[model samples]
Target: MKIAASLIATLALAATTIAAPDNKHGNKPNKPIVINKKVLQTSKVPFIPHSGTALFTNWVGLNVDFKYVKPVFDLVNATKAYGNGTLISRGEAHITTIPPTEYDNILHPAGVTIEELNALAAKNNRLQRARFGLECLGRVQVVTKDGVFQQSVQIILKNYKDILSYRNDVFKLFVKKGGNPALFAADNFTPHITIGFKNRDIFIEDGVYKGKNACIHPIVAK
Candidate 1:
């Protein structure tokens, strides 16, 4: 009778052990169940151009007189930056009026139509009469993150406040029209013309060049 009772108790214990939840695979140990409430953004974001040929965006600025800067380019070709017998001769030089950044995602938000922007662009065309000047200071070189030296020009522009005001007003309207507000540079905008992307050793003696009325147009993205 004692053997029988012992076997019955052992079977009961085994049954209880098997029936209990397995903590490793099924139930967590006294932990509250967590559910993620945040939704992941799945929509594809827009592209913003930083450097190079403004490929995906539009640009507006004053057309440079290539004839005037030819000598400077000749000097640049002789520098260490372009010493590989490479010469830069045929890129448009212009003071950035409305940078490529201004047009990125300009029509993303609701209610802002391209027609409105085009109308504003028409008003801005009056800026075609705006005259400015640039004084090429000297060579500017910086060690890139890849440990290679990169160089470009250090230039100063006259009547920059007017440009800034125009940029600010356009940015405000863009935001009010539902464009992204974060893309605009409301302050701390430095106006500099990029002479070369890889060569910084080229130097042009300090000189002031006056500009005629430049075109101010709306940049359309590709």
Candidate 2:
């Protein structure tokens, strides 16, 4: 609540700011348009409000195996199986190819960062590598009482520094502590839409694949 209130206040300040008028007009119009943060927020109230102390719950999201771009990969898998003579399908049907679209958000178009590329290059005997991370404005993953899993990764304004710091903290906490760790990532930041989730206790201190399912994405880079 405190954090949310603070953010709201900050946003309110920005909302109230008046843009300087252009001096090109000889009349020098001086009427300032005042913006009401409250009205703006109210207007956009239907959007998910993930910020604020009590409103957001953060967790260390973990996924051991992620079949990213599964739809595309599924097609490729079929081709490989057919070539290997395992599929044994010689049908006259043509392969209907669908051009990739933006629906698959896993493929990062921003490309790899210099730091990430360097990290991989520093390791010897690696021919190719891709390092990418996402700062989405959506809901974080959560587990329901019925064992169902949910995901939310909207295009929320992400804090890059905080995320990097969180990654480090996640590493140290999970690696060094070797016990139950607390995760407090988002705070009334905001929410857009529910993305997806693997819905499993990922960070098992003493389990295979670090106790995370391979199909889930990790809160921090693994």
Q: What is the TM-score of each candidate against the true structure?
A: 0.48, 0.17
Candidate 1 clash figure, as a count: 1
List candidate 2 segments past 4 Å from native: 1-153, 156-159, 178-222
Highest TM-score against the true fold, candidate? 1
Instruction: Point out the worst 10-residue segment of candidate 1 by lDDT.
Output: 35-44
User: How do the residues 1-222 of candidate 2 rate in per-residue lDDT, one tens digit apiece?
Assistant: 998777666544442331121235333113321212222122222212111222112112111111222321223223321111122111111100100121011111223122332232223312111112333212233333233332222212223343243344333433343422232222212211122223332111111121112222212212
Cα lDDT computed for each candidate against the true fold? 0.40, 0.24
- Please state every model's RMSD to the true fold in angstroms: 27.1, 25.5
- For model 1, residues 1-222, the per-residue Cα lDDT tens digits are 998777666654553443332335422213221111110110111112223334434544444444444444444445443223343444544455554444444432434443444444346353333444443323343343333444443234444565566567667776776666765665535454444444432222211111211111111111
For model 1, the stretches where C-alpha displacement exceeds 4 angstroms are 1-55, 76-90, 105-124, 179-183, 199-222
lDDT of 2 at 151: 26
